[model samples]
Target: MNILAIESSCDDTSASVLSGDRILSNVIASQSVHIKFGGVVPELASRAHQQTISQTVEQALEEAGISLSDLDAVAVTQGPGLMGSLLVGVCFTKGLALANDLPIIGVNHMDAHIYANFIEHQPEFPLISLTVSGGHTQLELVREPFDHEILGKTRDDAAGEAFDKIGKVLGLPYPAGPEIDKLSKQGDPDFHDFPQALLHEGLDFSFSGLKTSVLYYTQDQTNDFLEEHKADICASVSKAISEVLIKKLERAVDQTGVKTVVLSGGVSANSMLRAKTEEMANRKGLNWYAPHISYCTDNAAMIAITAKFMAQRGRYADLEMRPFASV
Candidate 1:
């Protein structure tokens, strides 16, 4: 089956084409307007999506060497993202489906992240997934396709969000996760012991306290002091987040007795987390899976792959379906 997928869950407007299990093209247009604000501005993001969605989809179809009439189904991210952003994709997709008289599928953004692993590495059933993104951080138990049990989720800020917020504190650019990850490579994670929140808690994650700790630590430092210690701060902060995530994931593995574990979402791009998780998985003799760096962040390829699974289960949606902002 040929499926076209659209993902505008947040700041990036992306489209992908999948012919059966094979991805033909994945196109994304990222919005840079949020950088000045140090975060995504929802209204501006919505507007950007409006302007880019059509062209993005067109480019994807062209790159895939297909026409709208060649598509068998249309899939779109339906929720757990900015409402306006979600609406743009959903509405545009509905129009496309209507125009082509094609079947439509509504996919959960978080679920798409997990299925991203399917794009390259298909994990066995009953595996564990640690999905960390700017808006969410959660541990899920995957029993089967489309069957997800959220084991634990962030109580406040997500791990990726914490990275960006802390990066902002360090006078880094917006969407600071990548910046922090890059800087952490040059400094010592032991330079300062940033607090790791809820380390003793169960599987649930917490990063608000860590962000607060960074805030308080930098509040009294001079600009010169911050400049000198920036790399160390980034390294220490990265270490703190990575430790908490790995600890909780380890706990989940012990409790569930699942031997296959995977990492998903945007934060899966972090080198430290990837390395540490690989080590833990090796130490425990467990199978570990992570998507290629390109698939680690939001993209339509994951969404299209997810739609392929939904298609197998006959999980198509009607045009009347509405987008949601939360899972």
Candidate 2:
């Protein structure tokens, strides 16, 4: 079966064509307009999708050498993202499904992130997955492809959001997570000792205190000082954030009888986090699953792959399914 997927739940407007387990084509149109704002603006993002969705889907179909008529089904991200952006994709996808006379599947964005591992590796269920994205950070115990028991999640700000907010304080550009992650590699992580958030409650996590700590540390700083110390500060922030994530992931390893751990979501694109996760996973002798940098952010291949599973499970949504901005 050939599946065409759409993912416009955020700043990225993406589409991909998948036939069985192989992807025929994958295309992503990113919004460069958010750079000036230092982050995504929902209305602006939705508008940008409106302008690019058709062209992106067209390019994907062209690259795949297939028309919309060849698609067996249409899949789209349904929730856990910007409402306006999600609505744009959903409405367009619903219309396309109706025009093509194909079954439509609504996918959970977070679930799609985890299933990204399926794009490269086939680590079966009964394992622990740490999903870290711009908007979400959570741990899930997977007993089946569709059955996920959330083990831990951020109580306040998500790891990626924290990265961007801290970047704003340091005068970095918008969408600062990737930038900070890059600079952390060159700078000394131990240059500044940032506080790691320690919340001892079940398996849940919190990053608000750490966010506040970073904010307070810069309260007395001048603009020149911020500019001079930005790189080191970013490195310190990345270190602090990764420490919390690694510690909690380790806890999940000990709590669940599962040895496999999957690192996913947008923040999963970070080099420091990936290195730390890989190191800890190796040290503990656990099987690890993580998506490539391309799959780490919002993309349609993962959405298409996820829809393939949801389709097999008899999980199809009708015209009434609405988007959930938050998971």
Candidate 3:
């Protein structure tokens, strides 16, 4: 089956086309307006999606060498994102489906993240998925397709959100996770021992306390001190986050006795986290699956992949479906 997918759950507006199980094209338009604010502005994000979604969809179809008439279905991200942003994609997708008399599938944004691994790898069932992103962080137990159990989730700020917030404190640019990751490589992680919260707990994750610790640590430091030790600070914070994640993941593995692990979402792009996760998995003799960095972030390819699974199960959404801001 030929399917088209749209993802506008956040600042990026993306479109993808799939012919059966193979992806034909995936095009994304990222919003730069949030850079000045040091975070995503929901109003600006929705407006940008409104302006670019159609063009992005058209480009994706062109790149895929397919026409609208050839599409068998249209899938859209329907929840766990900004409401206005979700509406933009959902409305557009619904309209397209109505006009073409095709079926429409509403996909959960988080499930799409897990399905992203299928783009290049056949992740085994009964696996552990560490889904970390700007808006969410959680560990999921995947028993089968569409059968997921959320073992633990962030109590406050998500990993990617913490990265950006801490980056702002360090006077870095918007979407600071990548910058921090890059600079952390140049400095020592032991420069400062940041706090990692909820360690005694089995699988739950927490980063708010770590963020508060960084805030307090910076309050007594001079500007000169911060500037000189920026790399080390970044390294220290990155290490703290990675350590917490690894500890919890290991706990889940030991408790569940599941050796197959998958990681996805924007923060999964962090080089330090990826390396540490791989190291831990290897040390424990666990099978690990992580997608390419492109697939790690929000993309329509994963949405299409999820929709394909839903379609196979004879599950489809009616036109009355609504988008939600949270799971």
lDDT of each: 0.94, 0.89, 0.93
True-vs-predicted CA distance for residue 150, candidate 3, Å: 0.9
lDDT (tens digit, per residue) of candidate 1 on 1-327: 999999999999999999978999999999999999998999999999999999999999999999988989999999989999999999999999998899999999999999999998878998999999998999999999978899999999999999999998898998899999999999899999988888998989889999999999999899899899899999999999999999999999999999999999999999999999999999999999999999999999999999999999999999899999987
Please provide, for model 2 over 192-306, each residue's C-alpha lDDT reduced to its tens digit, 9 standing for 90 to 100. 8987766445667777787788899898788788777777788888989988888888898898878898889999989988899989989999988789888989999999999
The residue-level lDDT of candidate 2 at 280 comes to 97
lDDT comparing candidate 1 with the true structure: 0.94
lDDT of 2: 0.89
Order of all candidates by TM-score, from best down to worst? 1, 3, 2
Model 1: residue 240 alpha-carbon error in angstroms: 0.3
Per-residue C-alpha lDDT of model 3 across residues 10-30, encoded as one tens digit per residue: 999999999998999999999
What RMSD, rounded to one decimal, does every model reach?
0.8, 1.5, 0.9
In model 2, the runs with Cα more than 4 Å from the true position are 199-201, 222-225
Error of 2 at 62 (Å): 0.8
Looking at model 2, the pairs that clash are: 38-174
Q: Which portions of model 1 miss their true places by more than 4 Å?
A: none
Q: Which ten residues in a row have the lowest lDDT in candidate 1?
A: 118-127
